[model samples]
Target: MMPASSATLHVVATPIGNLGDLSPRAQEVLRTVAAICAEDTRHTGQLLSQFGIATPLLALHDHNEEAIAGRLVARLLAGESLALVSDAGTPLVSDPGFRLVRAARAAGVRVSPVPGACAAIAALSVAGLPSDRFVFEGFLPAKAAARRERLQRLAGETGTLVFYESSHRIADSLADMVQAFGAARPAVVARELTKLFETVLDGDLEALLAAVQADGNQRKGEFVVMVQGAGDDEDAKVAEGRRLYARLNEHLPPSTAAKLAADLSGAPRKALYGG
Candidate 1:
């Protein structure tokens, strides 16, 4: 058994879905900590109850994280070991607790990680996309225009892109992705991961959109959307050319727009003009 030291903060990763995924080390840290700082006290309370752990729970979510961080840091400095956890998965990976971790570090308190489950990483492991180089874009903007704008910016990215999305907006988000990244871009939609109804669907953007639209069930769970990155230099050039063509086509004829976009982006005019 490892000894819990004073003036240390243990960052524990809980289960994303299946409770069995929580590591033995994470459970040990949770039991040994002076207290567990959670995004949702009640939710974490339930988990602790299952394990018969009696450690006290303290709420520390986004709204009051800044205010609570300082006090928590003081406690850590005063020799009270604490554990930080989110509702599910790793803390600070689209969840809260960054401020507390940062504060503890600044106060010269040791902050340690008991890593286990992370939804993004979990999804990426089975995504079948290029995982060597990828980007995790937490949650996109809630608004359609903002989300589309963000997708447009990422359209040219060469590394695989991962995103967390809610069920309510999955359809619209996929539609926006189809528009921004093109219908043929390979993508995967992993839903309800590690849960009873876990589903992982992979296909071209348009096909995936159709699958989701055809089934209401596909739109009912938490989602991790992984999009294959732009291909080689030639593929990137074509993507850039298409983006430019989209804008210039609005103000110029199709042939003229294709020519200008190709010249500016170093793409082939024949490819842009569909020749």
Candidate 2:
């Protein structure tokens, strides 16, 4: 434990899949920190054992982060330098530790980042899609209806769309994406990233759905799905407008739904009404 004035919180990134991807700095930080707060103690304990880093492990996950964050911050304030890590990849990227990090920062304790392999960044690097400006919608709703609603809201986004999905729902998610974004929208599915059996599948949304359905292996691992942004073409706008109109028509009159969809999708009112 360091002095109170010198104590800090190190937010370290662990390997997403390939253990070799863990950086020396991350390993060093984990080895030296008074204790490492992990999303899963048993899982992280194995990782620590692989590197022979015997620092203490503390369980800090979504279920308990809020309740324990204050206590962790108090320990930092009392001069115990600590580290935070998730089960995989960076902390707080669709993982736990948001409360702990915020608590430490608000307590005036220093918080540092040790960045490494992130599935989103890794997938983006090779997806060949626009990455300069993109949105990371980590995991969509698990249910089909809620998931479809979310996709519909993002239908008009002009930047790349990235998502993390589980193996169980990958097929259904891709199907909903096809319905919302159109079958021809270009997309890529990076599965089992950084690990053996890693595969990156790319094509239109329809093709992606078909591929995943045809190949059972494609739906068996963690996935990072990237979709091309909505284009500025007239056809694209009109297509988006039709999707919006259909959804809005459920809650509003046809004329009102068409007007609102036209306004939101930037398609002509006549186009929405098929004039």
Candidate 3:
């Protein structure tokens, strides 16, 4: 059993873009820790050097985190406090360091968070969508078919949907969203948050897609795409009714399918009967 003095693991949040966002306490933790576990040592090194923090860095990223977590936990049990940081934003929030933090807690080492900049939260703050309840979907699947499939599954979600996306996929993803969620669905695309060229775009999915396609610069930064939730119960029922009517009409007569779908989905028959 480790003694009561087991070292702590500080999960630190670094700046997503602006260097000024790095809190004073985070700098102190980076300075005093025995070593900082970073997703990318070189990127973290550049950040530390800016503030003159000379703490040695140990590489701990997706590819190597599982293999090294045990070793890091052993060090914690040996009374050497360590800090874990991602290249940017909060650690383990779509970033690495999950394994190390889990291992440290499992081994009776205390784990604490030093929260600061998180792109998802930062974007949400500026997004005029509902903040009362929301979901953070880290990043959509990279492939087109898979991405569309995922969006289809979330079409009826009532809480605001938040997703992080790379610059290259922003346009395609928004297009897919318009297809899956409808052209008139409200959404916001927050790009390069906290950085000099930051832009937050607001409109229906169709308009947003058009803007991204028309402006090359709009598609050129890290993105936090937020979508307003599916509307009231009647709206959801109409959507479900239409989906069901399409499948049912293949076998049954159009009128019969519309009646059945409207009954099953709690939507008005007139809405599904026409098409």
Best of the candidates, TM-score:
2
Error of 2 at 76 (Å): 0.6
Report the CA-based lDDT of candidate 3 relative to the real structure: 0.90
lDDT of 1 by residue, 171-225 (tens): 9999999987889999999999999999999999999999999999999989999
Error of 3 at 116 (Å): 0.2
Comparing candidate 1 with candidate 3, which one achieves the higher lDDT?
1
For each candidate in turn, the TM-score is 0.91, 0.92, 0.90
Q: What range of 10 consecutive residues in model 2 has the weakest lDDT sum? A: 1-10
Backbone clashes under 3 angstroms, per model: 0, 0, 0
lDDT of 2 by residue, 149-223 (tens): 889888878899999999999999999988788799899999999999999999999999999999999989899
RMSD of 2: 2.8
Query: How do these models rank on TM-score, best leading?
Result: 2, 1, 3
Off by over 4 Å in 2: 1-4, 233-236, 252-275
Q: Cα RMSD for candidate 3?
A: 3.0
Off by over 4 Å in 3: 1-5, 239-264, 267-275
